[model samples]
Target chain A: DQQVKQNSPSLSVQEGRISILNCDYTNSMFDYFLWYKKYPAEGPTFLISISSIKDKNEDGRFTVFLNKSAKHLSLHIVPSQPGDSAVYFCAASLDSWGKLQFGAGTQVVVTP
Target chain B: DVKVTQSSRYLVKRTGEKVFLECVQDMDHENMFWYRQDPGLGLRLIYFSYDVKMKEKGDIPEGYSVSREKKERFSLILESASTNQTSMYLCASSSVGFGTSGRNEQFFGPGTRLTVL
Candidate 1:
């Protein structure tokens, strides 16, 4: 069974707009949550992460909000650019060194 | 910057052939991982090693084996290639302790796309 799930397979947004991607997890033991971005033919790169102790974390134009009570997490991109078009994956881990459980991934497309 | 390199970016093999995927990390990281990314299935861990000569199976281990003779290199072996095994294989590495800002963020190599006929 998939512990992490991204119900939406794809999302499209206009440039200079806000893009939101949602993820849900079934495992409550997860303590660390992260978001990764992947381009075509390239490996995933870490974007941002939020610890279970914090409700929200932001870096530049990206922000990740975690709701532990709901077991849901969302990633938001402000002023979305065309370069932001890529696949976003949500991952959770029991600890910092433990293996990660990844969601199916959501494809984000920013149109002009 | 941490750099992970794979032996091949693309490979084609025939059925019944043995396949080997090699991964190397420039940084002196102790943990290495192998994952396969498939459409709709996302990325599934195949194997991981936290130290030299030690390995642990991930969610999927059938038809796959791993070798960690050195701290920087991790190898994945497929005894017999099958069509179902054709997919993009990824390698990642991270330090044993807390990574940047207390998160064990992994550094990934450009994936190897393996095609089995």
Candidate 2:
């Protein structure tokens, strides 16, 4: 059973616009949520993360919002640039062990 | 910078052949993991080791085993390669341990694309 899921497979956005990617998970034990970006033929790189104790966390153009009651999280990239085009994955973890559960990635395209 | 290196970037093997994928980390992390990424399935953990000579099976452990002989190395073994096992394999290491917060991000290798014929 897949505990983490990304309903959208792809998203296209205009440059400098806001791009939102959504994720849902069934596991309530997950407390740490993260977003990773992957380019073709490259490993996934950590983008941003949010803890269950907070509803939102931000870093530069990337921000992650977590809603524990709804078991949902969304990553938002404002002023999205062409360089943001890549596969985005949402991951969750239960504890401090660093083991993670990942969702099907959403491919984001930032068009000029 | 923390570095995680994989033994291969690409490998092609015949079905039923034994396969070995090795990973080495330079940061002396206490935890290492092996994961397979498939289209529309994301990344699935196969196995992980928290200490040398110790390992724990992840969600998908069937047909796979792991070894941790040294603190910085982890090996994933496929007893018999199968077509279904062809996928991009990733290795990651993190420095999360006792007395430290688990907020550490896992550093990943470039990944090895394994093709089982």
Candidate 3:
């Protein structure tokens, strides 16, 4: 069974628009979440993470929001750049376990 | 920078041949992991090591084995390679790992695409 799921397989946005990616999980035991961005022919790089205690965490251009009660999370990237186009993966883990369970991934394309 | 290096970026081998994929990390991390990536299946863990000579099997460990003789190096061995095993392999390391729960947030290598014919 897939513990994590990303319903959308792909997303396309024009330059300088908001790109939103969503993820859901079935395991209630999970309390920590992370997102990774991967380019073609390269490994997935860590993007951002949110603990279950917080509802949102924001970096410079990336923001991650979590709703523990709903078991849902979303990532928003504003003013998306061409370089932001890549496959994004959503992963989840329990607070104590170090292993990551990843979703299939969503391919983001920022067209100019 | 905590860099993880794999021995090869691409390789081809014949069926039934023994293959060795090497990985080394310079970060002095205590955790090392091997995972295989396929087109639609995403990345699946094969093996991981917490310390020297201590290894654990991940979700998919059939037909594969691993070794961690030293702190910086981990090796994956295919006793007899098969076409089904052809895919990209990734090695990762982290300084802290989840003890009973398993939490080393993984830092990965570039990856090796292995093909078996």
Candidate 4:
């Protein structure tokens, strides 16, 4: 069973526009959510994260909104840049012990 | 910066061969994990270690074994390689502190793509 799901396989947006990626989870035990961005042939880099207690967390141009009631979360990048083009993965964990469950990634393309 | 390194960037091996993939972390992290990435499947965990000489099986640990004799190294072993096992392998490490909620970001290595012929 897929505890976390990223239904959209790919997304495209214009540079200087906004890009939104969505994720859903079936497990209620997950209290932490994170987003990672990966480039070709490289490991994923951390982007943003949100706790279950908070509805939203922002880091510069990246913002993560969490809705515990809906069991969903989203990563929004405003004024997306060409450098933001990469695969984005949504992940969740039950506690702080380091075991994370990851969703199928979404390929984001920012066009000039 | 937290750095994770894998033994190989790409490898080709014949079926039934014993394959060993090595990973090392310079961050002295308490947690290390191994995962396999396949098209449309994303990353599937194979095993993880929270401390030296301790290991736990993850979602997909079948046909795989792991060793963590020292704190800095984690190894994945394939007793008998199979074509289906061909995939990109990733190693990640994280430090989990008390009351941290396990949200500590994991640093991953540039994956190893293994092809079983």
Runs in model 1 with CA error above 4 Å? none
Query: Per-residue CA lDDT of candidate 1, range A1-112, in tens?
Result: 9999999999999999999999999999999998999999899999999999999999999999999999999999998999999999999999656599999999999999
Which 10 residues in a row give candidate 3 chain B its minimum summed lDDT?
Answer: B96-105
Model 3 chain A lDDT-worst window of ten: A93-102
lDDT tens per residue, model 2, A1-112: 8999999999999999999999999999998988999999888988888889999988888888999999999999998999999999999999788899999999999999
- In TM-score terms, candidate 2 sits at 0.97
Output per-candidate TM-scores for chain A, rounded to 2 decimals.
0.98, 0.98, 0.97, 0.98
Docking class of 4: medium
Instruction: Give the C-alpha lDDT of model 3.
Output: 0.88
Best by TM-score: 1
lDDT of all predictions: 0.94, 0.93, 0.88, 0.92
Off by over 4 Å in 3: A95-97, B97-104
What's each prediction's TM-score? 0.98, 0.97, 0.93, 0.97
- The global Cα lDDT (0 to 1) of model 4 is 0.92
Query: On residues B1-117, what C-alpha lDDT tens digit does candidate 3 reach at each position?
Result: 768999999999999999999999998988888989876666778998888999999889999999899999999999999999999999988767443323446788999999999
lDDT at position B1, candidate 4: 64
lDDT of 1 by residue, B24-95 (tens): 999999899999999887899999999999999999999999999989999999999999999999999988
Off by over 4 Å in 4: B98-102
DockQ of 4: 0.63
Candidate 3 residues A20-80, lDDT tens each?
9999999998888889899987888888888788899999899999988889999999989
